[model samples]
Target: MFIDEVKIYVKGGDGGDGCVSFRRERFIPRGGPNGGDGGNGGDVIIRANKKIDTLLDITSKVKFIAEDGGKGQNRNKNGKNGRDLVINVPKGTLIKDLKSGRIIKDLKENDEAIIIARGGRRGRGNAYFKSPTNQTPRFAEEGRNGRDRWLSLELKLIADVGIIGLPNAGKSTFLSRISSARPKIADYPFTTLQPQLGIVDLENYKRLVFADIPGLIEGAHSGSGLGNTFLKHIERTRVVVHLIDISAADLLETYNLVRNELALFSSKLSKKSEIVAINKSDILDTETSQIIAEELSKKISKPVHLVSAVSGNNVKDLIKAAADLINKESEEDLLRLSLPDDYDAISNKGLTF
Candidate 1:
């Protein structure tokens, strides 16, 4: 029941109507109108909650309507205000208007909230109509209708590092070993249907959150295999851990195919900081692993590491390297932010992507 995206209808509560009554007190014979004003309607609000990891609870009940305000009473007694409706969703949820497909808000942080719809306005009472020209006005204003709208909700996973590769390339295996997340792993391809997030505690102070995206095959950018559904989950990732099955045939070809698919999907993603890991090193001889690593380094122009998720060989060193890269990128980002806003060097300082 990991429902991430869903469409739902929401409406604000309608305001209460004003009362129309005249004062009929025993002592006060010339008493004027004494009607009370109505209370305001409730609002429909959406808040980002870190505890909510999915939209399953919200999807169960599609329509959400707030409570209506209480009507006005006699003797200038105001009505009770309606209770506002609050909806909780995952932190990385995005809300869009159904008709125009315009993005209302992107809730990426915890406790972030936005008012999706407003409650109806309260009506006026006869007491408010007491004017010099028309002192004995009898009519009272009507309450305004609440706003109703259909909205589309989407969820994108936020992670520090993304583990991506072709089917059975050991992406999930690597994640399962490095962290506490236990994803379905099999000898066949596409064992994981959804993205899995895991937290890695390499050191007491250094914590890393990694996401294992669904396997990407050729034509993945054009809706092939798992397609772009899971690909967007890693858009916020700072580093990409590219896994290559050294035991598979044509390792470099598989790597290039995945890279090409990334370029087609998003140029910024293709340029993300990445490191190549030769997976399944335990299945290969020492000489063979070294040969493959040497060639991969030269081709990708990045330091290639040999790792075996099954034996946990060189996994620590690989993670340390990734942590170093992540720290380096963070420092550069802070430096760019410190630069003057109007400085011409800001653009070239790797600020925007």
Candidate 2:
């Protein structure tokens, strides 16, 4: 199952207690304090794993705690340090403090890690209190407590190109034709329940990652349809492939609706490099297809591409164009730019089925 968001409680390990002892030997006439200091505690860390595409693994376990350090022993032997707890999540997972709603870290690259909770400091032994004026001091400090907090984890699929449009716009069909990702395709709307990733390999060994997000409808920004729930998944994409059904009566209206929903969801999303694609050209005649493409191009004031996902006509050219745009955008950062307002609130509400 694909899970994009989850909430968990994490805690660091506690420090070990110090030891109090005195040196006692037959040869030594005077014995001083032989106590040892306590060991430090372990830390709680979150790491990014490229192999993981969802947060399903982490949601199974709600609580995570690191191991505590061992206590100090006699003969000036320090205690052993606690083992660190590492939690693996997807590459685009974002961690935030649940209470304050502050972003702690954004794990964009593989192997990137952040320490969410810090361990406590070790206590000092009685020997530390011994001095020239005070002999055989019997005071020892206690170990400090570890840090604990509630954290929220949100996953945004990182892809080169994002395919978006209204329901039944042939986004999934186009993705299936180009790559190996097999998403549920049907005549009905919202066939795709989750975000699907596919790797399209082009000539000259060039490759592009395509992400298919669920379809959108009016009021999508306010959670009207599946589009609002899954829209955040495309926030990290470099370019957007706006797929529109050419056979629809009001093509321009549908296109504008999708664009307006995107703008309402995120201004950055609306401003991203977009390639308008007129899908389902196989059903329409040559003249009808050209008319619709031309009309939509003029309405949007951008170059509109004519392609048929079912018949694979002009699909390669569209993929190449998207790949070129993705290549140019890939030179920059792939992570989503930080939004002015905290988006953690939206993630906490959870996605509806």
Q: What are the per-residue Cα lDDT tens digits for candidate 1 across 1-353?
A: 56667899999989889988889989988788878888888999999887777777887799999888778888988778788999998877889898899988888788999989898888888999999998777878777777889998888777767898888989878887887777889988899888787777755325787788889999988998877777777676778899999977887788899899988988867878898999999998989899999998898787899999999899888888888888888666633322100000000111010
CA-RMSD of model 2: 5.5
Give the runs in model 1 whose Cα sits over 4 Å from its true position: 27-30, 204-206, 331-353
Q: Pick the candidate with the highest TM-score.
A: 2
By TM-score, how accurate is candidate 2? Answer: 0.91
Candidates' TM-scores? 0.90, 0.91
**Candidate 2 lDDT tens digits, 42-138:** 9999998776777888878999998887777767888888899999988888888999999888887789999888887888777887899978877
* Cα misplacement distance, residue 252 of candidate 1 (Å): 1.7
The best candidate by lDDT is 2
Error of 2 at 93 (Å): 0.4
